[model samples]
Target: GYSYSNTVPGPIGSILGPAKDPKANATLPFACSLCGSCTDVCPVKIDLHHQLLTWRKEIRVKGFLPVSKRISMKMMSWLMQAPRMYRFVGKMARSIVPYLPRFMLYNRMNDWGKQRELPIIPKQSFREWMKQNHDDK
Candidate 1:
């Protein structure tokens, strides 16, 4: 998985460069399960899993990550941190995703729906169910 790139240059060099070795790029770390075996086995006790996470951030900063992935992460971060927004977006997505045309949901833009059938949104959220059934009387 490692290679010396003195042979590669220019646009080719960018792909094979020391910093951007395509073989050693983001996908390896993304595939990792973070089992921490690397961290445990290192004689110097390096935080290997943490280092892998740091590498993901570096890859993201270097604009190696996909635009859609970056946007989705940002959207998730914003939505998850705000309770009302989370509830609203969750409800909205549940309502809209099912009704969306197959072309809209299964396009290249939606990587998730491209490979798999979209999830069926439930009729009621947990909060809504609990409100009706578990309300203080």
Candidate 2:
């Protein structure tokens, strides 16, 4: 759980490089949310919740994910942040809602799925919601 980075340089401090080891990263194991979305979204239908927990143990617990995968995740975060591009994708998502599978579209595997309904995407956006509900008065 402790980060020791004397081998390479990272942002903030270098745990794997030259800075003193951080007391630790999170020590807790990934607990199962048992959300079925993983299963539903899985192209191969693997029980991803189980797989996720397993990977968490192997990776977070054992330092197992490939470096490429870690880099790709960082890349994905960057790609997701462009407002115009993200909005284009959001529009596509809304357009595709009618065709999205129950598992992926509905968040069915999520623990809260049992009690929660897939919220209707409103015709009006959140800004509209705020405008209707929030008055200077």
Candidate 3:
């Protein structure tokens, strides 16, 4: 039997309900892909993705995110604010990631890459490409 209430939005919405303790359900929102599929199919025209995003913000604000994730986000924030460092890191990743062993890249520490093959790293970033192709003009 098909169960409509078992979808991503149902459980997340239930856990995020006003009477429920959102702090206890901090990890629920991150489970969504934010693809808006649930929003599209909703007969009531509920903005499910927006609700998920709001829950994510609430989780972050309440400091419920894991330490490792918080540290990584901080590091990424720092890296993005430094233009030179960002470019350097991008260059290094493009040059190095392809040659890294599969075991190293797809290990448990890399949850995003564990289940799927990573896309081929491009030789240059979009900024580099734009500079090369259009800067002369």
Candidate 4:
């Protein structure tokens, strides 16, 4: 039921508005869900999602992203590339997150947790499960 017009206005305003402040418009691109719904509905077949991704890259390159977000992104990138470290962190999270106080997990710093409840942590990782269930077969 959502319309492309809803998402189009922000980017259009940022591009056409007299003030060319990247910092001011930095949040505009990220406002999108990147679901490609806008692109699907565009009459001109514009790649709105891709354009939004480009804007995000430009904003990050221009250092408009907040310091906390930048550090978190870097940390995630590092963790993702190191498989052993990633597994260790995952195990640690599974073991520690549920026991952590609400304030610790749902604070202002946890933007993802602000409006949503964390999912119940599983007893074992998917890798462990797969090994147990499939490797013997």
- Which has the greatest TM-score? 4
Top model number, lDDT: 4
Candidate 1 residue 42 Cα shift, in angstroms, is 14
Q: Would you estimate the TM-scores of all the predictions?
A: 0.60, 0.33, 0.69, 0.72
Q: Is candidate 3 or candidate 4 better by lDDT?
A: 4
lDDT value, residue 39 of candidate 1: 73
- Record all residue pairs in model 1 with backbone atoms less than 3 Å apart, i.e. clashing: none
Looking at model 4, residue 123 earns an lDDT score of 88
Per model, how many backbone clashes are there? 0, 14, 0, 0
lDDT of 4 by residue, 1-137 (tens): 01222332554543322135667566666666789887888888888778778877888988898888778879999999999999999999999998999999999998678789999999899999999989976
Better by TM-score, candidate 2 or 1: 1
The alpha-carbon deviation from the true structure for residue 47 of candidate 4, after best TM-score superposition, in angstroms, is 2.3
Q: Which window of 10 residues has the lowest lDDT sum in candidate 1?
A: 9-18
lDDT, residue 83, candidate 2: 67
Clashes of 1: 0
How far in Å is the alpha carbon of 64 misplaced in model 3?
2.5
Cα deviation at 100, candidate 1, in Å, is 0.9
After aligning candidate 1 to the native by TM-score, how far in Å is the CA of 109 from where it should be? 1.3
Candidate 2 vs. true structure, TM-score: 0.33
Per-residue lDDT of 113 in model 1: 68
